[model samples]
Target: MLNRALRLPTRAFVQVRSPRGAFDATLGNLSAAGARLVGIPERTIIVGDWIGIHCVGQNYSAEVRWHFDDTCGLMFEEPLSEYQIMTILGSRVAL
Candidate 1:
């Protein structure tokens, strides 16, 4: 079993980059390894699709792991450091 990182609930706008182009998404929760994106349109994304997520001027490469309704889970290509996560969150709130 994989150990889950601690997730912090947040409301921030995130940019999702796919082969088609970039789309706006809502960051509902965040962690070092993954995040929950809400308000994405249904059928717009699929599992295993590689994507880039941008928030607060920070970027992360990730893969789509799961989706339900308008929400999807993304697993980062590399786990983010705690400091990086905090910086993104701090900047988000500061905006």
Candidate 2:
């Protein structure tokens, strides 16, 4: 059970609330199980920390699985469905 899942790159602005504080980030890419968050600006987030991610009017509870170079990977507490993923990506697409 170790196949690398597909990821769709995105560039939506979002807010992340962690133990350190809330800050902005880019939704770099996404999949059903997790996502890549870029442009953290600050490197305060650490692995094993649970963070709340707010994007496009939706809130997601995710764990900071890895972090480095002002970027982090988040594993969603509950995997998102395909419909939800497409909806999220579509909402931010410029016309």
Candidate 3:
């Protein structure tokens, strides 16, 4: 499914922390609104639940929009700076 609503597609790592615990995974695709995070094998997050996420060294609040085994989409609560976004994308691409 193509989320055409997002203009820019980037890649970054997403850090998710909930009541359960904390985990980090690569978000292979990103946008200003949300991101498609990969490498997550756990299903402890719930949709619409607020979470703390770190990407490109910048931390932000986000909510779980959707998820599946090893993959998920998180909607950011705040807008990220262009530099931050680019840095995240670059770092992920390099890996």
Which candidate achieves the best TM-score against the true structure?
2
Question: Tens digits of per-residue lDDT for model 2 on 2-46?
Answer: 889899988877889998888988888999999998988665588
Ranking by lDDT: 2, 1, 3
Q: What is the lDDT of residue 89 in candidate 1?
A: 72
In order, what lDDT does every prediction score? 0.84, 0.87, 0.71
Candidate 1 residue-wise lDDT at 67: 84
Best by lDDT: 2
Please provide TM-scores, in order, for all candidate models, with all chains considered together: 0.86, 0.89, 0.76
Off by over 4 Å in 3: 1-3, 7-11, 93-95
After superposition, candidate 2 runs with Cα above 4 Å error:
none
Candidate 3 clashes: the total is 0
Residue 40 error, candidate 2, Å = 0.9
lDDT tens string, model 3, 9-91?
A: 55566676765678987776767776777776565676777878776566878788887787777788876667767777777
lDDT of 3 at 33: 74
How does model 2 fare in lDDT?
Answer: 0.87
